[model samples]
Each structure stands twice: as C-alpha cells, then as structure tokens.
Target: MASANVVDNSDHSRFDLLVDDKPAGLVAYSRRGDNIELVHTEVDPAYEGHGYGSLLARSALDAARAEGLRVWPLCPFIQSFLKQHPEYLDLVPQTQVTRFKLA
Candidate 1:
C-alpha cells in the first residue's frame, strides 16, 4: 500500500493528505497571530473510512507543534481527536481552552 503524505497548503489555509500524490483529505485552519484555529476537516467521500481525516488532523497538529504554534481546535473532529489524545493538550494554551470551549 502506498503511504499517505501530508502537506501544509498554507496559501489556501489548509493541510492536505495525499495518497498516491492525489489529495485524499484536508484540514482547514485560520492563522491568528502566533496561533492557528482549526476550522474544518474533510475527506473525499471516496477516501472516507480510510483514516485520511485522522491522518490530516495528526499532521496538522504535528506541524503546529513543530512550529511552536498553539492550536485552537475549533473543528469538531479536531476537538474530538484532542479529547481522546490529551497528550496534545500542551500545544493548546490553557487560558484559551475555556474561550474555545475546549475545556
């Protein structure tokens, strides 16, 4: 099986997951100063249930961690993912958690 690849298409404010070099899913976000607010996530219907959304979410979050940027997971999928994976909580500012309703 071909491994999927993830790329931040920042010009379009999204991160894409590619399978065989084709877009399989994307996680959209908006930049806010030194932070990013995850706005949405979508996987091509054809790729649904293939874990593309989760892959995209993980990649987007990993990128945020690598860049020393905080994430506000406004997207429900991201929020749910974070809820299940509390290890990523440190990448989100404690103060904004309440504001974003993440707490």
Candidate 2:
C-alpha cells in the first residue's frame, strides 16, 4: 500500500489526498452547521484502479470517526466504496446508510 496522506484542508473545507508526493485523489465535503456530508471523491484517472480511491475513502472516514462526525456520502463512488468496505460502515450515520442502500 502506498503512503497516502489524508490531510484536512480546513481552509477550503475539503480533504486533500496525497500519495507518494502526488495529489492522487481527493474527498471533498462540507459542514452544514452540524452534519458533514461527503460531496465527492475523485481519483485522478491516472491513479484509478490502484486502490488509491479506496485508500482515500478509508482515510476520510477515519477522520470523521475521530471527530465524532456523521457522514452523508452524496458521491456515488464514496457510497459504493463504503458499501464494499463494511468495516468502515461504523463511521457513517446509520440513517444515511439506508439512503445509500447500504443498510
């Protein structure tokens, strides 16, 4: 596994995904006063299929968990990635899971 750093770009209110010194992917989201929703997960086409997206998702979810934050994955890729990786399911809100059909 590559050393992917999941950094909080609080200034921009997004998550910056870095891998091997390159910006391989990103998970963008916003806080609506209370709940934080995952708006998007984009892996550079050149970095796709290398599990970097999954890595990015994992890191992002971990951050949410650490902050006691609930996630609403509006991005299809983030939703599907969470479905495939049920281990991280605990990080997402139970109600939100149903919306993603992960419940």
Candidate 3:
C-alpha cells in the first residue's frame, strides 16, 4: 500500500496531499468569514487516477467541519465531489445550496 497523508497548509491556503512523503496533489481554498471557498484542485499528472483528488477534497472538507465552517465549492472538482458525497452536504450553507445545487 502507498503511504499517503493530507496536511492543511494554512499559510498557503491549501490542503496538500503527500504520497510517500512527496507532493501528490493540492486543494486550494480561501477563507471567507465562516465559510471556506474551494478555489481549485490539482493533482500531478503522475499521480492521476490514484484517488488523490478525492483524498484532498475529503481532507479539506473534514477540516472545515472541524473548524465549524461552511463550504463554497468554487472548484469544479470539489463541486463534483460534493455531488457524489452527500454526507458533506451539510457543510454548504443553506443560502448557497441552490446556487451550488447541493440540495
């Protein structure tokens, strides 16, 4: 099994995914009041098809939950992830539910 880890690099406003201690992917975000706006997601081509994107998304969303913050998925990857993972639907504010089509 590959050794993988996710870390929140607040200084850079992104959650990084490391595999075998090497950078594999990242989820960029911006904090807005009580919400976190997911801006972009990128996984190295070498790491593609390894589920690193999903891992990054989950880690970012999990962090938001722990911090009691909502999510605004501006990134297409995050938006698709949210649609497939309804368990995280609560993280999106009610006001943005329709806008992001989370509901």
Which candidate should be chosen as best, given lDDT against the real structure? 3
For residues 1-103, could you state the per-residue lDDT of candidate 3 as single tens digits?
8898999999999999999999999999999899899999999999899899999999999999999999999998998999899999899987777887875
**Candidate closest to the true structure, highest TM-score:** 3
- lDDT score at residue 23, model 1, on the 0-100 scale: 81
Candidate 3, residue 15: lDDT: 95
Relative to the unseen true structure, what is the C-alpha lDDT of residue 26 in candidate 1, on a scale of 0 to 100?
Answer: 90
Clashing residue pairs in candidate 1 (N, C-alpha, C atoms within 3 angstroms):
none
Q: What would the per-residue lDDT of candidate 2 be over residues 22-57, giving only the tens digit for each residue?
A: 887788899875467889889899878888888778
Of 1 and 3, the candidate ahead on lDDT is: 3
Per-model TM-score, in order, reads: 0.90, 0.85, 0.95
Ranking of predictions according to lDDT: 3, 1, 2
Report the C-alpha displacement of residue 72, candidate 1, in angstroms. 0.8
Model 2 C-alpha lDDT versus the unseen true structure: 0.82
